[model samples]
Every structure is written in structure tokens, then in C-alpha cells.
Target: MGFNGIRPNATRKEVLEMIAVIMRDDNDLEFKLDSMNLSLSISVVTEIFWVLNWERLSALRFFAWIRSSKCRRFDFEGAKKMLDEMRQMGCDPIVDTDNYLLSSLCRSDKTDESCQLLEEMQERNCLPNPLTFEILIYHLCRLGKFDLVHEFLDRMISNGLEPRLTTDAAFIKGYFNSLRYEEAHKYVVDSSV
Candidate 1:
């Protein structure tokens, strides 16, 4: 990832200058990236992301950006668009990346959008790990969306993810509150096995 003599901690103006040069030469961002062998380090990507104000970047670039920086403030719609673009580009984001995005969404109280992103992950055959399930289930439980919790629990079980006891307890309580006694009992019995 030669940055064409761009040093570490490049200023925003420098990054923009680089972008201008690339865009001027190719007018195709992806093509320019491919030509430059744009496997950038996280720091460089972070600098670029900050410079671009976290606009909807390409999937690979966005991944690098996220990997390089702490995304404390997320634009949910922008992140979702980036995920969709990543899928379209056939670049399946790793579970950790998804988890980071999920956590950010949950922190912002964007539970519904988090669920939608999880569904998108499923559609792409990107299996969610236990943490993924935990984040969504916890938020759904907080929102009193027991019906969704049950569905996510079912998916978790089918995916071979053993639900943590605490998460299951919350799920059970939600189920009961939602008058889903049968489902609650089913999970209780299954867990005891």
C-alpha cells in the first residue's frame, strides 16, 4: 500500500489532494484504487475517512477505515449503504466488522436498523456470532420486542449458537410478558438439556 510518498498522519488537505489526483486521473474511484494497489493501512484509511467526513466509501475502503479507527459516532444510513455496497461488490464483511457496526447501532438506540443489518448479513450468508445475537437480543429485550427475540433465538439455535444464560433469562421474561408461554417453556426445556 504505497501511498505515493504520503507520510503517516497526513493532513486533511493532503488527503483531499490525493483524492483529487486520483479522481482527476481515472474518474473511477474503484479503478484508481485497484491501480494504486490500495490495500491501505487503517491509519491511512482513517485519515481519508475523516477527510471525506465518512461519506459512503467503497466496501474495501470502508472496511479499512473502520478497522483503523474507533467509530464512536456512526451515520446509520451511511453505514447501511456501505454494507449494501460491500455486498454488491461480493466482499463479505467479517463478523467482527458486523459486530462493531451492530454495537454502534445499538449504542445509538438504532435497534430496528441493527436488526435490518443482521438480516442483510443473513441474506449474504454471513453467519452472526454469539456476540451478534447477544447485542440484538439484548436491545430487543429492552424494547420489549419479545416476538423478535424469539425469532432471533430460534435463528441462534439453528445456527448452533448456544445462548448465554443471562441472555436466555431475559428472553424468557420477554416471552412470558408477551404471553408466549409455550415458546418460553420450549426454550426452558431445551436449555435444561
Candidate 2:
């Protein structure tokens, strides 16, 4: 139950070695990971996430594991560190990785931090995908941050991405929930035009 031979007190190096084994046995990744009884720290999870970045499926499975397991909560600092470490190693994290961080930040009610990270992602030339904008817009709308939501929506369109109908509904819902009935009505009317 120890990562398929990883000791309970395994160091970062050992955990990394285990990651290698997991990568090599890609077909059995879920089975191997599910069988392991490891409690990973934030830093270790970051490292493992970085290592799995290039392997989309593995990274996704690992991300799901991180979410469901008793692993430490991921924070903005951990995400920043992972990105910085990747840059130092002569690589940039993929957009999916950034999206994951954004989702995590938003779920934690750290929308401000997520916005900051979005800026950093742009500065690093890691252009965000449509999902990125959707994530931010959804969270911002939920928090009744219409100003930022509008801003992101504009940015999303400028990037040649159309806002999904769900996004439009979220905006309308946000206005309604905020007790701005007039604004919501106006929005629906104007959008129809």
C-alpha cells in the first residue's frame, strides 16, 4: 500500500523514482496509483504534477487522485513554485496545468490570486485556452463579480473564443441573484438584439 514499494517515509527523491515507475507503467497507472497508500505533501504533489505534465492522461489521473485523496490543499504559492521551477528547468507548464491551478484557486475562493496567476501566465507567454476564460468567468460570476466577469468575457471574445450559452446564462443568473432584476432583464433583452 506504499506506492507499490515506496516506503512510508520516502524522501522526495524516492517519490520521484516512484513517479518514474508510474510513468513507465502507463497502462497500469490508475491501478498502481489506486493501490498505493501515500499521503503526499503539497510540494511533492507539485513535483509529481510537473513530472506528469507532458503525459496528459497521467497528469489527469494524478490530478483526480490529488483531489480525492488526503493530500494537502494546493495553493497559489505551490502553483507559482511549480511554474517557476519549470521555467528554471528550461520549460513552461502547459495550458492544462495552468487551467488546473486556476480551477483550484477559484474553488478555494482565491479569485484574486487566480487573476494574478492569469496575468503571470500571460506574461510567461503561456496563452490561456478557452477553458481558462470559462473557469474565471464562471467563478467570478458566482461571486457576483460582474465587472471582472465582463472583463474576462471581453478578453475571451478578443481571443476568438465565443462564450458558451452556459456562460451567458451564468451572467444572467448572477445579475438575478444579486437582486439586479432590471439589469438582468436588460441583459436578456439586449443580448437578443
Candidate 3:
């Protein structure tokens, strides 16, 4: 089947046969998809992979591909579905997975969704690493959302997850940018203490 013809549960026997053949190969699904230049949506890809019973490694590859710069056309909804599919398949996302998703969301300027996902990660005990916080904090600060920066910083501290100096600086800069010098200076002092 041609790449453009690929869709969720494609009825064409050729497409089904081709997908099975590809899955049987040693190459990764994302590689196969990209090589074919398939314009398949994520849902279609997810369904195809699910039907092929290729979730374990395929989920990782899908997340990695979605996080890559080459995947400029995908969106959060698809990514979210992919993650959900992975979790439902007993593949709980790791910190790296969370970081990849978080970074992707931030890159897309979906800061609000990123923040919510960060909280979800915490609730799921898929703790965010320094890099995750840095990405969200930096983006929030850049957008002059100092309140969110502070809230995230506090959440980080409460969770005993120390932000790096650069993240702290971003928060401080965010405060100052919003003309909250007192809060910024206090943050510097409190963090130092």
C-alpha cells in the first residue's frame, strides 16, 4: 500500500499485509513510517500498531519520534493518546518519557497543558527531572507567567526536587520582569538559605 493510503484500520488487504510485514522486520516502526513518507495521523499509527500487537518497543519509538524536530505536524491530542495507549498496555512511562512529552509540549508552546501533564506525572509517581522543570519553568518565565513559575518552583521544592541554578535564575528573572523585585530578591535569599 502507498503511504498516503495508510489509515486507521485500513480495509485494504495489501495495507494490512504490508504493515504485518513491516512489523516483522527488524527496523523500527517509526523508521519504516518515515521512510515510507506516510502522512498517517498518530491515531492511525497508534491503531495500526495496536492491531499489530507491537506496543512494547513501538510506543517508545513513537514517543521518541513525536519528540523529534522532524515531527512538526503532530499535536498534543495524538501524543496524549499514544501515551494512554502505552500505559493501558502496562508500559508505564518513565521519567525520560515524561521529559520527552513535556519538552515537546513546551516546544509547541502548550505551556498550560505541559503544566497539567507535569502534575499528572507527579501524581503517577513518574517524577519530573530537573530538565523537565527547567523546560516548563523557562517557558513560563519567558512568557512572563511569573505566578506559574513561582508555583512550579514551590511545587518542586515541596517535592524535594531541587531546581538547578539556571532554573532558579529563570524564576528570579521572571519575577523581576514582572516588576516583582521583592519576590525575586526573596527567592534568591530563601533559596540560598
- Indicate which candidate wins on TM-score: 2
Most lDDT-accurate candidate: 2
Q: Where is the poorest 10-residue window by lDDT in model 3?
A: 2-11
Per-model TM-score on C-alpha atoms: 0.55, 0.70, 0.67
In model 1, the Cα lDDT at residue 108 comes to 80
Q: Candidate 3, which segments miss by more than 4 Å at Cα?
A: 1-33, 39-63, 66-71, 172-186
Q: How accurate is candidate 2 locally (lDDT)?
A: 0.73
lDDT by residue (1-193, candidate 1, tens digit) is 2344324455556556656644344445444444433333444544554545455434355354444333442545555555565556455568878888887888788877898889878887788998899888887877788778779888998999988877887778777877879988997898888
Off by over 4 Å in 2: 1-9, 12-17, 24-31, 34-72
- TM-score: the better of candidates 1 and 2: 2
Give the range where candidate 2 is weakest over 10 consecutive residues by summed lDDT: 66-75
lDDT of 2 by residue, 1-193 (tens): 4544434655766687668766786777666765655656656766776667756535656655554342234535745665576578665667887787788888889888899988988888889888899889889988999899989988888988877777778888889889999998997897788
Off by over 4 Å in 1: 1-13, 16-71, 83-91, 172-190
RMSD, candidate 1, Å: 11.3
Give the Cα error of residue 175 in candidate 1, in Å: 8.0
Residue 157, candidate 2: alpha-carbon lDDT: 83
**How many residue pairs clash in all the candidates, one count each?**
0, 0, 0
Cα RMSD to the true fold for all candidates? 11.3, 5.3, 4.8
